[model samples]
Target: MQFTTRPTLSGTFGMVSSTHWLASQSAMAVLEDGGNAYDAAVAGAFVLHVVEPHLNGPAGEVPILLAPADGEVRVLCGQGVAPAGATVAHYKGLGLDLVPGTGPLAAAVPGAFDAWLLLLRDHGTKSLADVLKYAIGYAEHGHAPVERVGETVETVRELFETEWTSSAEIYLPDGHPPRPGELLRNPALAATWQRLLAETAGAGDREAEIDAAREVWRSGFIAEALVRQAGRPTLDTSGERHTGTLTAADLAGWSAHYEAPATYDWNGWTLCKAGPWSQGPVLLQQLALLPPELPAQGSADYVHLLVEGCKLAMADREAWYGDADGADRVPLDDLLSPEYNAQRRRLVGDKASFELRPGAPGGRTPRLSAHALVAAVEGEGLDALG
Candidate 1:
């Protein structure tokens, strides 16, 4: 939550809840105890695991970008990536358009806890035990389920909740989400956290804790627990004979990468982001393409223009966006460049709408298709057909 190139006397904290406030307070406790932003973030994320498991958890990906006072911005990609054996064609063969959530096979290499530990080792002021105490306490003792969460689960019908009994049993108990005031507990997750603590104890003070936690997280327990919770054995790992090459080792091999994010200057704000995976620049493309001033009335026309621009951008994203290290980095900037937007904007008009024929590569529209000839003599259209 803290962002700055140079250390100042103060900073701001952002949150949207009674619970986030509690987590922030814990983080602020770390800060007040002389911990750095890295330490605060680590503490906060762990707290979120217990308090905000719906949105995030040890079982989920959590990519982060940290900019400290060092003048260099560091990005930690906490988002999990598909296992080495996984590929686009692999899922297609599994009769899937997209891998479903928190599933065993869809489980990416979880690197958040490790990354947090690492950041602390190098920059943290508090010890590993100190940062984790709050979270561990919450996990072991338990807390009441937040009100809004149960509503969301019911609203979604947990429709995509995956039919496995282990998963269903835990979530759909009695065919319903836990009522808002219900006592929420996760002793298994707590046990895992404790093991991480023990493993990290012997390692070098704080940083090594991160490395140790990584190993614990990557252990077979991850797959086992997921299987137990999901209430089923692992799904077929061998995707079509050729597509799914993922062995369990592939899961262990995947890790989050670190890199610098891209930045742009727009509307006086210093727009910052990372490429390929990040969704920022695509939004800027739609914004820049619009006329500098707003339309007289926010009518269907204005909405239509935005959607059309989004369609073009989304098509480009699906076709090209991917892991930069593992795949080709598309010429993403080209799509949002001022020159490109200007040309595309020129195609728009204030009058009646026009249909645009999208074409193949090189951004060119294909010529209209030829039609069968049905020649007719002057004033003899019907006779000619006969």
Candidate 2:
């Protein structure tokens, strides 16, 4: 591959890369201090939550892939489930054919925190205090504000100022967005992490302490706070404000778990990804559909093929993929099978297809949700899968 940047460095100890530099530094520090890769990842993820709040937050979901030195690859599921009250009837009652992309109604059960904690507890060696210290420090002492963060805050300044006052209290300091490179502190977030740490003070062991912190996050003050705040309506993308349906019961009932990843074998390599519940498998499907040999990377033909493949895969995603919870679900096995891919490959042509083509699996008709179909029809559903 041509190097658009510097060549890779040879390392024996460890390496860390993240969207933000501080997160890399934080992970490297953990590794340098004798913590394992899992510990480093946990520390890095928390720092991302602090410094890249505009991109991701503590309340967001994260699906993790862990491949240890001696163990097989595993997927840590952090994708939160829909709240019990988040039923089709409830949303339909509100005249919403689709969940608004932004606002309180879009909020699911918060899963990232428990996901990280679970990774640390099961696969990591560092204590919760150690893993969290970097994030807490950054949140309390302030980190250099990223330009995108400033821009995002500015874009939402009016919304924050008027509708989401709670958000304004955090993002808008003194009624204005923080300038880029300015030191910005989130004392409230820092206190939240600190309080979780404090709750584990009396635990007998590191494992027990981690468990205690998890409990606090689920059933304690965190759950109570989320449930209370969700009672109030918030501004959403539909221009209709709505209260969140996420309850304390939802938070308490959910827990992160590990599962086998969906795998695709090509040549001698075995690639893995999260199940259809996430967007991960779409890439795998695209790869499966492509010819073994192709045009040079970034060439017009290559780009065309990749883009078309992704469009096809995403069509399948929209039609069938969802939380794996029912007896009668999308037949993922048949969809990923070689026979199905060969059939799908035949559909690719010189021209782009605006029509949605979802393959039939075991004669079962693909069920596309009304919202998904709308997104597909509007031509807003295609994602760059490569």
Candidate 3:
């Protein structure tokens, strides 16, 4: 008997999918209440912050792709940029080669909160209070902590206790991380939302109110708190403490913007994704490198082709992808050209190739360090597993 891992899911009505059930349910509830996709997404996203803090939080990024019935598809860039003080010289001075995986030094200008607001303001019909209520309820009352949440708390327990005392106050209540499936509450998070709402009390209409809230977040109390914390040195994965480079000026300077999605047409289907700034373009690049006809689903040949294609695409992503600003802008137009992919597709041979090969689009040289090449090979291997 063959048992498939992925079951066929069919639904008569609309469906909302997320990592957590509470988030999916919250989005569904919004839709049931006559809200649009944008409104439902905002509601669900906020719920995720409360229920799955281990996976996502207010400080994270969420690049949203909107396909409106009446309008063309657009990409909302929610990913935050590196702080102004994050420079090669600064890191070199810190005796660090790579960005620390954990700590204030690793922090970016938080984009999630503002991105959600931007979506709400431009596309959604719901008010800030309407979408935020569910998250507030979950945070103030309680939500069942997923197993990974407890495990994450355990992983960072020592750090929280020793340096990040504020985190310990919430994740380690009474000197212990919450057990899995135990009801956990974060009243402080709820209070913060409440305060944000309070600040927008007198703002005129819906759009005006959302704008006011954005101001409060970017230039007001939220910005102040973030800067204060970032200024303090915190323990990191480097076995040392380091202060963040983020500033209120950086927060104030940044805002979420909408851009046309990078797209690829394959086998009568067009796939749109975020631009070169993100890894989204890698999928399109991979498809361009693959054959017109794919092997049977779940087959070894199909998996092999896909994995090989991903390696080539990811290498290019590491080599060519960068911020579309100044001298570092990626030559996306040249990379996505059919001529380029045709040349790259030849790299896929009969056997597995462990070499990390990045194509030279527009005759531009790929400047990857020896260490980075090794890391890319290892990273792509892990990505192939799941």
Leading candidate by TM-score: 2
In model 2, which runs have C-alpha deviations exceeding 4 angstroms? 1-3, 375-386
Local accuracy of candidate 1 as per-residue lDDT tens digits, 1-386: 55689754544743222257657888888877777777788888888888776777765665566677877776676666656646668667667665654345555555565566656766677777888887887777766667666766676554426433444544456777756666566666677777767766877745565666666555555544543443343433233212223344644665666776655557786655556665655566666666677655567887777877764454444444565464344565666677767766665555433233221234632222111111112222222122
lDDT of predicted model 2: 0.86
Per-prediction TM-score, please?
Answer: 0.72, 0.94, 0.93
Best of the two (1, 3) by TM-score? 3
Between the candidate structures 1 and 2, which one is better when assessed by TM-score?
2
Any residue pairs clashing in model 3, and if so which? Answer: none
Error of 1 at 231 (Å): 11
Count of clashes, each model: 7, 0, 0
Report, for every candidate in turn, its global Cα lDDT versus the true structure. 0.59, 0.86, 0.87
lDDT by residue (1-386, candidate 2, tens digit) is 56567886889888999999999999999999999999999999999999999989877899998998899999998989989999989999999988898877888998898999999999999999999999999999999888888899998788889887876877898877877767899999999999998888879688899999989989989888889888888878989789989998899999988999888887789999988878788888898898878989889999989988998888888776878453137567887888888888888899877766776656666767766666656764333211
TM-score pick, better of 2 and 3: 2
TM-score sort, best first: 2, 3, 1
